[model samples]
Each structure stands twice: as structure tokens, then as C-alpha cells.
Target chain A: MYTTMSSSTTTTTSPSKPQFRNKLVSSLNDIFVFVGGAILALLLLWSFCSFVSPNSTITFNISSPTRPKPTKLVEPTNSETTPPMNCAQNELAHDPPDHTFYDDPTLTYTIDQKPIKNWDQKRQHWLAHHPSLAQPDRILLITGSQPGPCKSPVGDHLLLRFFKNKVDYCRIHGHDIFYNNALLHPKMTTFWAKLPAVRSAMVAHPEAEWIWWVDSDAAFTDMDFKLPLSRYANHNLIVHGWPNMVYEERSWVSLNAGVFLIRNSQWAMEFIHAWAGMGPQTPNYSQWSKTQKATLPDKLYPEADDQSGLIYLLLEENQKWADKIYLEHEFYFEGYWKEIVGSLRNVSDKYLEMERRSTAGGRG
Target chain B: MYTTMSSSTTTTTSPSKPQFRNKLVSSLNDIFVFVGGAILALLLLWSFCSFVSPNSTITFNISSPTRPKPTKLVEPTNSETTPPMNCAQNELAHDPPDHTFYDDPTLTYTIDQKPIKNWDQKRQHWLAHHPSLAQPDRILLITGSQPGPCKSPVGDHLLLRFFKNKVDYCRIHGHDIFYNNALLHPKMTTFWAKLPAVRSAMVAHPEAEWIWWVDSDAAFTDMDFKLPLSRYANHNLIVHGWPNMVYEERSWVSLNAGVFLIRNSQWAMEFIHAWAGMGPQTPNYSQWSKTQKATLPDKLYPEADDQSGLIYLLLEENQKWADKIYLEHEFYFEGYWKEIVGSLRNVSDKYLEMERRSTAGGRG
Candidate 1:
């Protein structure tokens, strides 16, 4: 059976506009004479008065007793418990916070009569505000031809679970292809070379103070990691883990895609745009993976992964544009299976405690 | 001046169906008595009569004086100079002889009363049979932010140089962000992902076979690639590329995302559905910069990226579902810049020669 998605169209009819005809006009000289004499003087005077007068308005909203508010009045039904299926409490079960959030006047939220499970109103709003939201400036992500069993829970599931909710995210599942037989990690950096996700967002949302990129499984000790919408009130790239917190540098220490934010500053957008264009042989990452292995400092490691490739990109191109890169310590943290789980659990515990405390207060 | 992009909000008006009068029909027996005793008996008798009597007619088409014969219609206004820009053209633009085979018909094809600049009606027909042509399934090539760099000769120049007569190939400068990036990719893989042009054709004429996705730069070399439409028939993903070509034993082979054919095949759609899924925390890739060193690869890659991720997933999980993934090597060659550009250039030269020869023949 075909399922119906949301509808966004309506048809309305309106009465035709009234037509008027003017009497025959004089010739060009006569027309000028008509305007140049008393009529022109009166027009000029009227224009000056309209410009100077505070009361002057192009149009007026004339309200009358007969004109009613457009709001649809809700009639009290005879049945107390019964409601339309769309308005049923069952659907609200998924969104109980609506009851709480609605009470918070600060949020200034309007509840949709029908909470569509499929359509994202927030995304819709963002899209409408920035028509470009639907089409991305650039889509940057990692891809592999043959991914291994991936001893690391790093590819799809882990990636999706962590970040899918924070923002608009899509996980493309390419066939199990690897640059180097699942040995080398997904060096999305090379692919990002072509995709311009970062630069695009800045251009698309000028009002957005900052644009952050976070990997799915990256751990956040506190939900405070949510970049304050006002953080870089003025635009600038607020990358963490990068050295000196500058636009360029090999220290690449800035927050990993694991968590990096752009202040939507001119410097950041220009930097990203320049970067997408300048590259060699388009960086045949597939071939490179086959030959090179990852080595941390003194030891050479087999199977360079997503992390290693990132390090390589940051380091190999360090001298050319190192100064622009900035490293943030707050964003730099070790990534591991246990650590991620621990962080998630810690966040969960805090949430539970908050809930418990709130409930107790309510009871008191 | 702002030029509107080629996209329409398909407002699906779900005709509100009256809720059935179920209060009286709660009992199955009562429902059967009401339906079976009257309508069912009459239908049964009618069926028996049709089955028993050879003269009893069932199949019928409305015949009226007002009905215009299909052949009696006037030739399209552009018929002499251009081909129909109908949905069928969109579908045919993606199909076989047009994209894969040696017999080139597109060179002669015209559209909207104008000879297609670089492409022919043959290509249009190819797209008609392949619904996926205009619908970019995996890889999205977005230009700089804003719908038209109507000003930026950068991307436009590149596309024009590559796809000749193909003007609407790249969605445009930053229009990519207008449609939800993740949603569009998923739709491409799922039921909704066909070229809008092709969809229009299907609406105009439903009997077309497939949809083809061939960029202006793409060209047939050996014409050895057998169109996959023959095997899968409807909604099939057909292409020619080196498959099972392992990159260091990872079973890696790159295919041309620009020139792949898709028929309305269940397998093709399932592959797309299987490929599309949104994950949380996909980086706001809109800001990724070439200068930026790779950060976390696994973390940043979002779902619905260029089909590479999906390809990786398919291969990784092949043992679990091998039957669904078919390798259509005959129809698509890897259009990687390094490997195919030379051959493509050679083909372009040949095309020029062919064009000259045709002109000479026409003159003779």
C-alpha cells in the first residue's frame, strides 16, 4: 500500500480586480502643460507632505467590527475523551516534552496540530529561511571500496548512532570497498577535497554564527559541547584541537571532524574554498592507501585508518598552509570503544539524576 | 535577475476519503450479508457469463467522436528542429545505445525546437528508459553556495566544456543545498529518486522502460558494454565497470557515477533503499576545506554520500546478500579522470570527426 507523505499545496479563487478607463488625454505638449501647471505643483506639494508627515502611510489596515480574527475557533465537543486520530494522545506519546516545552513561554514555540512523524518541521523552516538548505553547497564524507570487518566499530552503525540526531546527517553505505583492503581507514579528507560541505554552509546560512562538524561516535563529556549559537557572535572559524587556534597549521589539532566548528567568518569560508580547489592528481587516495601504511611517531603501523589519513593530510600539507590551521585542546581527546560508551553512559546518568531531582521537587 | 531552478514542489493532495460507516458493520456476518448477497452475487454472475460465453465482452476502451486518434495529432511544433522535452526524453537520455552502444542516435535528436547542443535525442531516449538518469543517486556535485553563480564561469565553464549541450546537468552553483541533501540522496536510492525530467516524461507517457544518467563529458568508447536493461528489465541498475577488481584484496572497483543506467528494477531500488539512511552528527560538510587535514574519517562521513559508502557496505555485506548486487561491467567504465580521460578525449575527437562526416554526407 502506498503511504501518503505531507501535502504542501492549496488552491484558492479570488474575485477579479475592478477595471477603470481614463478619458482621452491631450497631446504630448498638452500633457506636459496639464502636469506642469497647477497639477504638477499640487503633486509636488503632496509628495513633500507625504515624505514629511509622520502620519503618511502607503496603505492602511482597516479593521471593522464585521471582520473577525482568522483563528479557527475550537468548539467544545460533547465527547470528553474522544479526539481525532491525528490529535490523539497516542501520537503525543512520542513527544511528551511538547507539554512541558509549550508551558515555557521563553521557547516561543507553536505546536503543529498534527505532528508528522516523517516531515521535519525544523528542517523545513531552515530550508525555507535558506532555500539553499535543500541543496548542499558541498557534501563531504568518507567512502571505501572494500571496508573490512573493521575491528573498530567505526563505519556505519557507530557513526550513525552517535550523531544522527544532532543535525542533518546521511550515511551512504557503499559496497565493501577499501582503499587498502580495509587496512587503511576511510580517508574522507581526500574525498572532501572535491566536496565543499564546509564552505557551502557558511554561504547558505550567513546568519549562522558557527557551523560545526562532528563525527558520529565522538564523545562529548558534557552536552555543553553544543556550540553556543552566540559563541562567535561575529563570524570566525572556532576550530578546536588546532594549534594556536588559527585558520591553518599542520598541528591539525583542531577538533577532528569528531567535533570542529566554523564561526562562519570570512576567513573560514575563504580558507575552505581555496582548499577545495588546490590539489594534485585529485589525490588518488585509493592508490595511496595501497602503498602507504600509518605510522605514529617512531613506529610504523599496518592498515592506516581514517584517523591516520587525516593526520597525513594535515601533516603533508602542513608547510604550505599551516598558519591558517588552529588546534583546540578541548576538542582533542582519545577515541576508543570503551571511552565512547563510558561518555555516553555518563551523559545518561546525569540525565537520569536531573530527571529524579526534578520529579522529587515536583512532588514536594 | 534570478532564474528559477528546474524543480517543482510535487504537492501530493491525498484526496480525503470518507471514513467508512463502520458503526453498523461491526459484525463480519452482517458485512458479508450486505456485500455478498447483492453486489457479490451480481459480480459472480457477470464473471460466469463472461467466462462461459465467448461473445461476452470484458475488455473495452472508451470510444467517442470527441476522442482524438493518437496518429491524428499535429506534429510537435519543434518536431522539425528539436525533440520532445517530455519525460520520455528524460528516461531515454539514460538508456543503452545512447550511452553504451555503438549506434549513436542522439547526434540527430533535437529538443524544444532546437538541436541539442552536444547531445542528441538518442541520449534523451536513453534517459527515458532509465529513471535514475537525472536523479543523482549517490554523488552530488554542488557548486559554490547560491543557486546561480550565473556569474561564476568556474563550474559552469567546466560543465559546459564537459557536457556540451547538457545545460541542466549540474543543478547549479549552490542550489544543491536547497533540497535536503540527505533526503535527496535517499530518495535517489529509494522510490522517489528518478530525474525530475524523467518523472515528467513518465507522467506524460507511462510506457517507457528506463532512465539514464550520463553527463556531457561521458561518451561511449568500445560500445562493448551491453546495456543491463535486457537482464533486469524494469528499474534495473546497469553499467560497465571493473568489478570484483580488488584494491589490495578489498574487492574495490570504481564505477562512473556520471554515466550509469537505471531501469525500474526492484533490485536497483532495493540497492538504493539499502544504501540510504540518515545518521546523526554527520559533519556540516558544507565547510570542509581542502587545506584542512583529514580529521576523523569514520566520524565525518555521512550516509547518502556518493554511492561509495553504499558500495562499500554492499561489498562488506555481500555474503549476506550477494544475489542483489549485480556487476554491470559491460555498460559502464570507470570514468575516473586518470584512467578514462584520455580515452574520452579520443572519443570526443571521433565524435567531432563523425559529425563532420555526417555533415558532408548530408550535403552530398
Candidate 2:
């Protein structure tokens, strides 16, 4: 289960564009991405927007005629009778007289419905009303495993550690973590499960700015590491990969899809839909798989996977998606496990040394 | 592992105090609690205080000598440097220009430290500053398992489902859930592990009034069921058991300590220390185990356990803790698994039938 968690291949092309090589570009013959940890690719993310301009947005007008603002704060007379405990969950457990996106009647949280539009505007409008959630960056980490007990005797045990690692990281960082066991979409099994989960999370957590998706097998080796959110100010999706492998060699293993950071913007919603289109749940799954294999002759697998699907989007539709997709290699976002396990001692030592120096310098 | 999760046995002694019999009461001979789900006891919880008297409090006076009130709200200068994602985490992500418990420099969050005094006032003081968190009742659901992979290959898998079940329940109810894997106290293992975790949670979540601890093996069979907080308004700790078994029969399996709801109060702090005093981590482990066996002649086990420890507190120290500890047996609160599993279909049918009638009656 841990081995198959990733679906994206390595793509190391962020600045230098990989020349379009139609027939299995022979330039990527040496780069061999394995199945184990290769699938747990990191997708670095922030909404694809100008961070310098918060006012610049594509969204519904704030002045919606249908959503008239309530004149008084709404308090729960009896919370248990109305949706159990969820009611007016702002800072004071009360909703102000001012209206937010929740007052809108047309919004839907289901993934199968028509994709959400003007989400950035809706979230901003809601945040404006709540204000308590308006601090710069707030993230919700979403992860899950298969619905049932693992087929492998120790599979569930491995998944348990994987989950614990995440919980520990979140606890120390104060980030909210969601662990899912049910299949959101019945047909979207295996690698494709994350899409529906992410989509649902956006609607479920309007308070969150980013919805981070990490694979069940992708443990946070560095508990203290924090994401560099500032660098991905302009990009909407971030993944670790070698762009040359994806574009020049047309290799399916150019980028990984195991882990990625995604903003709760309309762009992310649309991107998820487009990426999930090549999954088994879709009618065009066979055609997409055939296209992927034909496009990247180096691809050994027969069925269209999420990693190949992402690579396809980056290669065939480079003008459309590549600019927004970040191929991060400056640091190990989600490095190979074998290499990382051995080097952890050295990494721990370095971090400790740094801490010692900082303490000595009175920075602690 | 599932069977061992429970430390307390059944006790039916909320109103009718069990008559004490020095030797084996002989009355509990027929009561044999098999381990499996007996350990999944539910501790129904609420702070032990007069629900009608909101202003009544026994705590440190609002006026403290050393801690001075701030004149302005504090915002995060740089969240990454201090503590990754935790800063001013009230409704507005800002602290008002008023003193709360956080202003007190002498307060400690660790369990080994001196017990917190006048916590009610401190919590009330903090609530006064952040009115948003001062709702009538707010609960934090806390659960966890062993740090490493499970000895039973399926134990971790079972634990995962148990956790996911909780997540689902919390998601629907809009409650915060925390899953701890690390041992809060290295010496505190098994049932005793919950002590340090619960103690730490009280400090971590000052916003939460109740800290609910449910064993990992205890799954939430009924997703829609909500705790009757009003029912436990005047109690600080709740569990399921019969009083006769504990006092009269002197049986070890009287009240279940598996699942319980404990309030965040000075009383709870003192109570936890008393309960944990009998664990292996304490110096009295051997003596307590020996005394427990002598006191409860029916106890088959020879080791000091949390369930027996809780019973001991209720038995010997009845005047000190019994009033605060509620014995709940009204419904299926962490009931036996085999019984619940077989009856689920019938239970579902009853709920559906009621729903059908309600819908017909226009309640839908």
C-alpha cells in the first residue's frame, strides 16, 4: 500500500522548458523512476494568483441580491436539534448580522456537482465576515487509506505509522488534520481517491486557505520543517519533478503525485477536475491511458495512472498548465524513502547543531 | 488488544449505593465481563459544578500580582519562529488587550509539575477575554494508540478504523478531535497512557471545557448520536459500571474505565494524579496491586491496572471523588462489541422507521 501511494513521476522543469519530443524523447534514457516512493510526489501549492495583489480576483460580486444580510446575530437556541453541534462556529460560536457565502443558497459541497465558481471571492467574502480566520496562511491537511483492513498482514500497521507521523507533525505545528477511511467516490479507487477527497475538503473547510493532500505512505520525516509558501505565490499547484524527464523524454515517471500543496481556489477545483478526468472512474479512461502510453513510450504500465495523467497535462497542454505547476527540486519535498532513512541521522545532527548554535547566539 | 482496551468493569451505583461486604459479596458471581468490548467504556463528562449558578466559582481571584493585563491585542509577528502554526488562536487570530491565564508566567502545562490551582477562574478569565470560545458547552475529543506498529498485524488496522470512525463523528458534530501516538509519559503505558495525554490536552486546549477520552478499539457504532451535555452538566468525570460490584462484591470488574468524558478543571487535575498514583509509573504500583487484590478478592489479575485504580478511588476515596464521577448506564455508551454488532440492523431499522414517521409528520 505504501509503495503504490504515488502516481506522479519526476519532472525537473520549472525554468528551462523541455523541448517537445513527440516520440519517446531519447534524452531521458538514464532517469529511471521506481514505483515505491516515486508515487508519493509532492505538489507544491498556493493559488495561482498575484500575491502582491489581494484585490485582483476573479469571482462573483460581493453584492448578491439574493443573500440579504441578517439583521441580528444568529445564536443556537438548541444546537443539538439543528445539525447536532455545527451552528454559528465563528470566533464566538455565533454568526454576525453581516452575510457571508454560507448565506448563498446555490453553493454545493458535493464533488459530482457542477464545479464551484468564484470560490476565491466566496472564501474572501466569508473571511471578511469572520475576520478571525483572515490571518495570512491557514492550512488543512487531508489524508486517508483504503476503506477496509489491509490485505497485506502488516499493511495497516505501516499505514498506522504513516498516519501517526502526520498527526505528530500537525500537533506540533497546530494545523488541522483530517483522516478519511471511506471512499468518497465509489469508482475512483486506488490513486484516484485523493481527488474527490480534496474537492470535498474545499467545500467542507471554507475557513482554510490551502488544502494540503499527502499520501498515506508519505510520512513527514522532518517534523520541524515548514513549507515555503512565499515562493509559490504565483503558482496554483506545486509538485517535485524533473521537467526534462516529463517534456523532453516524454517519460511518464517525470513527476510524482504522492504529495502536493493546493490552494482552495477556483483554479484548484478546475485543475482537480481536469486531472481526475484521466482516472478509471471517467468514461475516457481507456483512451487517456492509450494516449499516455503512446505519447510516452518509456512508460511501462498499461493503464492510465494519475502521475501519467499529470505529466500528460504538463506536456501536451504545456501552455495551459505547466506555468501554474511548479517542479520543485531545490530541496527534498518528498525524497525517496531509502535515501532519506539512511541520511536522517546526519540531518538530525545538522539540525541539532544549528539549534545549538542559535541557542549559543541567544537567538533561542 | 481490543479486549484489553477496557480497564473498568460495570457498576450500577449512581443512586443506589452498593452495600459493602468485606469478603467476596458472592452477589457478583454471575456477572462475568468478557474483555472484548467491556474495556470500551464511555466516560460521560461535564465540569462538576452547579449548572444553574454560572457565576459561582472557586478559583484564584481575578486579580493576580505578577501578571498584568496587556493594553493592546497581540498579533503574530512571525508564527514560524516561535511555534510553527500556533499563536493567537482565538476567533480573530488575535489576543485582546486583556489578561488571561496565558499572562501568568508560573503556570505549567506538564503533568509532572505542581497541580494547577484555581483553574476555573483562570479558564473563566480566559473565556472573558475570548467571548467567542465561551459557548454553553464545548468538547474536545481525544484518542490515541501505541506509538509503534501494532503487535497484532490487524491491531493498527483496527485502530485506524476506530480513529476514522471518530473523525467522521467529529466532522458531523463539528467537534475538534486529537489523536496522540507518542507516550506522554514513557513509564505510563496501556490504560495509564491516557492520563498524561488528557492532562496535556487540558493545557493545549484551554478553549475546550470537556476532554473526552475514547479507547482506540472502541468504534462509534452510531454516527449520529450526540452526547447529552446537559445531562452531565454537574459532573466532571463519567463512566459505565455497577456500584455493587465495586463496593459490595469487591470485584475488580465493576466500572469500565475504557471510554470516559472528563472536564478541564482543577478537580480533574487532582483526580488524574490520584488515579495515576496506582500505575506502574508510580512507586506504589506493587503495594497498590497487592492492596487491590486483598480488597477486591475477586480480581483475577495480579497487576495494578487503571480500572482497579479508578474503582479504588471511588471505593476508598468515595467522599472525595464519587460525586464528581458519574456512573452512566442509560444507553449504549461504549457497549460490548459483539452485542452492538448484531443489534445494529435492528437499531438502524428503528431509527429509519422513526425518521419515516417524522418526515410524514413534516418534521423533515
Candidate 3:
């Protein structure tokens, strides 16, 4: 009676169900268990392998036998010493043995004994190892300014062209050039502007070995004239000076600072800072003034500027500065702005000739 | 005979040597001896005082009388425990008492027991204390691009103007903007470009708390609509989506990723890295192609772009990503490029009105 009722219900509700479907469902359960077990086993093995030797699993199977074995544990030695009882004891035990009392007659410090107190010796030692001091790596910072207060014969565009020409010249010599229209420091003016400009350029171009300041009015008449580094072997500054003005007359305007080369060393940086301090910005600037007749009797010229300040430092402060300063009379650094403009046509041929020679050498 | 010779030499060198000079020299010598003895005694006293009470050199006399008499030496305590014998023993003794093997089961690890395995909970805990998540300090980085390959109806300059208009809209709503002309990553295209652009903007503007990328093709039709931070209080990303496309259709083109806001967060940076990995530059990118029907049957679209990759990640990857993502349908995020351009005339009046209101408010 139950079988007849089940058949009647199936007929009324659904007709697709068969005894084969029930058999298939029973078989699927075994397959599901096998697949699930496989996945679980794999996951466990992966986790275990990862925990045992992290990062080794990727190339574990393929690595050759010659590969270095894992570091072996070292056995404790009988000769090993005992550690200190406390942190203070450990510090005292580990303190460097080289540092002894200065008054100890038995021990002597070679560095202290050496006469390194001299500024020239210290500067030479520092410059010898400076990373950027390589011959080719030297940087020539060619700065020119057409500030608002300063009047120029040429237009702004022409002034830019003149600076660009200087840039081209430096580039050909394998040196970096930084040119800006405005003065680097606000307080700096006229010849004094060059000091801050060179200082800032040194700061900006850390890789540069030297800083060369060419005034806005100054033109490169001798494009072929390559600055021989040998000439500045022991010098930090290179400027033009007339013997009559520098030695005999002892004039404030003895040295022309319009076009000069300054080594981009710490000494030059310090010197530039000192020179800038003596400008109109400082309290001691009145002492540097030509009008201060009682104080600066020799600097009676109206145009006593940063040049005069540099001269005062060289003459009064230290002989070491005088020794490092190269008073070059070999080259004509600059002439009057009018004279430079007039000679540009004549110098253009020399510039072209130098460019041709450089190009030809590069090609060869 | 020696005394007579010295006297004869002195008389020959100085004929007018007076007796008063000898008396003056003797008196000066006596005064020097007295002053030197006093100075040496004072120095000895000062040194002894310094040794007895170190750190009392400054304000030695001004300190309060009640200030504890410079600490007196104390005898060693008999109750003190013995120190470890060696480094190994010291290490064992110093090991934190709480850390023990898990199998011992006596101690419990709170971290292991907590549900930190759940990424969403972990992320929430991390983001809660993050400084950039502060509400008022939030910086919105708005970026758009006019890439080289993409052609626009208006000139590139006008496209820039359109982006600038969006910048103005965001600025009025109190947000920063970063505009760029090209894709940050060379290999990225279409929506893929947005990833690198957003990443770079995050790096460039560190002060920005969020980055909102608006496509060059998109425009701000509702300039008055301001996005309140509260809307995305718990969300890391905010994009527009339709319910039908997001759920039922599960279409790759469901959400508009063109104009979306991403929080400037560590989580966002990681997400961007993952997103960029799916671009054409990566080795796994070939798996995204629809032509490989056997592997990627679901991604059958010819243009399987960045949007498609994002949709794939959402559907197949973690649900935590979806929880953090806010899919808003409140307002339209993007329209067809042509439609946006066409509606510019209508939106100009609203923009002008908002500008006037802002100006009046600013003035008041």
C-alpha cells in the first residue's frame, strides 16, 4: 500500500526522477571526500614546509649540491671569557684603550705633535682628498647680473646672449655654469655682489670643484685661454693684480675682482663669508668705508667696495691668505665695458677658431 | 773671579744702570710670587670642591638649602639577587616571563586568540589612529590629464580650461588640485593611467589626505554640489555605481572609476600597487585577455580595460575591499564627453552664481 502511494505522488508531482540518479548521488560523496582530503593535505604540507625553512621552498628542489650548507652551530670554547656583571662594568670593559691622559709622558699622539695648527697645511690636506677636485670635474660658475639699480648699455636680451656665450665657453671646457639675472644676496651691490653670487653658486653646485665669477660687463676675449690648474696648485683664489698698485702704492683697488677663479673648497666658502660680512650689511661696514678717513686712511677712493675688504683681510689678518691668493698678471681679465664691446668683433674669430679645434679633437 | 767677570760685563753693557732699577726688579719679583701663590691656592680649592660635588659648578651657591645634601654613598644591600654568570645565562634570565611555548598551554596569547586574521578588523584598528584620517585636516588632491593619444573636441588648452573649472569647483568645496598633461606611467592607457597619476599625486602632495581623480573627458555639471566627508566616514574609496549593474548583471562596466575619491592612506597605496600590477606592464597582464577563452571565459569583452580588472578583483577577491568601497548612486559622477561639453553653456550660469555667493561671503 505504501509503494502504491509513493508511485501515485511521484506521478502527480514529477516524472523526471529515476533510481540511477540516486545511485550517482551516492557515488559523488566518495569523490568529494577524496578531493577535499587532497586539498587539506596539500595546504598543511605547504604551511609546514614554509615554517621549517622560510624562502627555501622556491628553489629547494633545483639547487645543486655545491651550494653552501646552512651555517653550522659553533661549540662553546673553554678559552672563552666571562661577561661583565652589570651594564656599567660592560661599558668600562668595552671602552677604547687608545684614549689616554694628555699628561701621560709614556704615550704620545702623532696628530697632536704635528704642526697642523697652520691654516695652509690644514687646507692643503683637505683639498687633496676632496671628491670633486678632479681636473675634469671642476665647475666654473659664470655669474652675470643686470640688477634693477645697475644700468647696462645693451638690452636685457643682449645681456642674456652675452651670459649664454659665457655658458657655451664653459661647457666647451667641460665645466658647469650657473647664470642668474638677479643678485643672489639682497645686501650685495656692485663688486660686492660677486662675493654672494660665488658663495651661493658653491652651495648650489656641490659637485663643482671651483667657482669662476665673470662680471656682467666682462667679456671673454681670450676664448682659447684655458686656465691651467697647475698655476693654482697651492692657491685657493686667482685674481689679476698690477705690481705697482699691489706692492708700491698699496692701493685699495690693487686687485681686480671682476673676473676671478675661486676654489670650491671649505676655505673659499669661509673666506667668502668673511668678505661678505665686511659689506654694507654689517656693523663694521663703516670701518670699510672710504669716508672713514681716520679708520681707513689708505682706502680713500670713492669706489671702495668688496675689493677693498678683501685687500684689508689679506694685508692685516693672516699671511696664509696672501700665500694662497694667486695674483695673476699673465692674462687681461677684463677691460672697460665700452672697450669690451668694441673688441667683441676682433675676439669672435678667436672664439670660432677654438671651437673648431675642440670639435676636431673630439671627433679624432 | 766669576762674580767679578759678570760685574765687569754688566758695567760694560750698561754704563747708566741705577741702584733704583735693581730695587724695582726685586720688589716686582716678590709681588709676582705672592699673586702666583694665591692663584694656585684658589685653583686647588676650586678643583677639590668640584671633585667632592660634581654638577654643582653652575648655581652652586643659589640652590635651595633644602635641596638634598649631595647624595651620600650607600652600603651594598645583602637582599640583592646574584647576577647571571655569562652572556647565555644573562639572556635566559632576561627573557620576558610572558613568552612561552604554545604547547605548554599555561599562558595565553591574546593576539593569537583575537580575530586579527580578519583583514577588515585589522585595517579598521590601524586606520582609526592614523593622523591623516583627521576630518578637518584632510587634503583633497584633485588631478586630471589630457594624454597625448586621446583626442578632444576642444583644443588641449580648452581641455585644460575644463579641468581648471573642475579645480575651481573642488577649491570652492575646500580641496587642493594637481593638474598634469601626460600619464605618469608610460605603459598605462585609458583608466589604467589614473592609477599612476593618483599614486604620483599622493607622493607630490604629502599634505593631502585624499586624492580625487577627475578625467579630462568629465566635467562638473553641478558646481553647487559639495561632498560632505561624513558621506565617506568609514570608506576608503568613493565611486558611483548602479544597483542593477553591480549586483544582478555583475558587469565589468558597472562602475565609473573616472571620477572617484581615494583616501591618501597606506591601504590605498597598497591597493594602487596591486591595481597597477594588473596593467599591460606586468607579466600577469596576459591572463586578462579575453581571446584566451579557456582561462578567462567570463571576461569576454574586447576592451578589457582597468575598469574590468577592478571588477574582476571585486568579484573574485576579498569582500573587505567591497566593504571599504562606497558605491554611491545619489548623483551622476560622469556623462558622455560630448554631453558634458554640450552642457557647459548651461552650467556656466550656476558656476557664476556660486562664485558670486562665495565672493560675497568672503567679503562679509
lDDT of all predictions: 0.26, 0.58, 0.40
lDDT (tens digit, per residue) of candidate 3 on A232-290: 77888887676566656666557766677888666775677666666765666766574
Count of backbone clashes for each model? 140, 56, 0
- Residue A221 miss distance in model 1 (angstroms): 7.7
Per-prediction TM-score to the true structure, in the order listed:
0.25, 0.66, 0.31
Tens-digit per-residue lDDT, B1-364, candidate 2: 0111112122111111122211222221111111111012122111111011112122111111112222111233344323333242334224465656765668665566767888888888887876656655677788776655554444455666556556545544546677766566666766677788888778766777898887665656544345667767789998876767877987776766778899989999899878878878778889999988877787767788777888888889999999988887656555644344444445445445544564455321
What are the per-residue Cα lDDT tens digits for candidate 1 across B1-364? 1111101100011001011110122211100001100010000000000001122122111111111111111122222222222221122112232232113333211111222232233334444544433332212221111111112212222222122111112111110110111222212321122232222222222222344544322322221122222244332454443554522234223433344444433343334434332111123222322111122122222223333433454455565444544454442232433243233334434444544564455322
Candidates 2 and 3, the one with greater lDDT: 2
Instruction: Give the winner by lDDT.
Output: 2
Docking class of 3: incorrect
Worst 10 residues of 3 chain B by lDDT: B40-49
iRMS per model in Å: 34.7, 14.3, 39.5
Tens-digit per-residue lDDT, A1-364, candidate 1: 1110101000001000011001111111100001100010000000000011122121111111111111111111222212222110111112111122112224311111112122223334434543322332122222111211212222222222122112111111000000111111122222231123344333333323345543322322321111222323443433334443222432222223333445444455344533332222235444444433432332133333333344554566556444544443432222322223223434344445544564455322
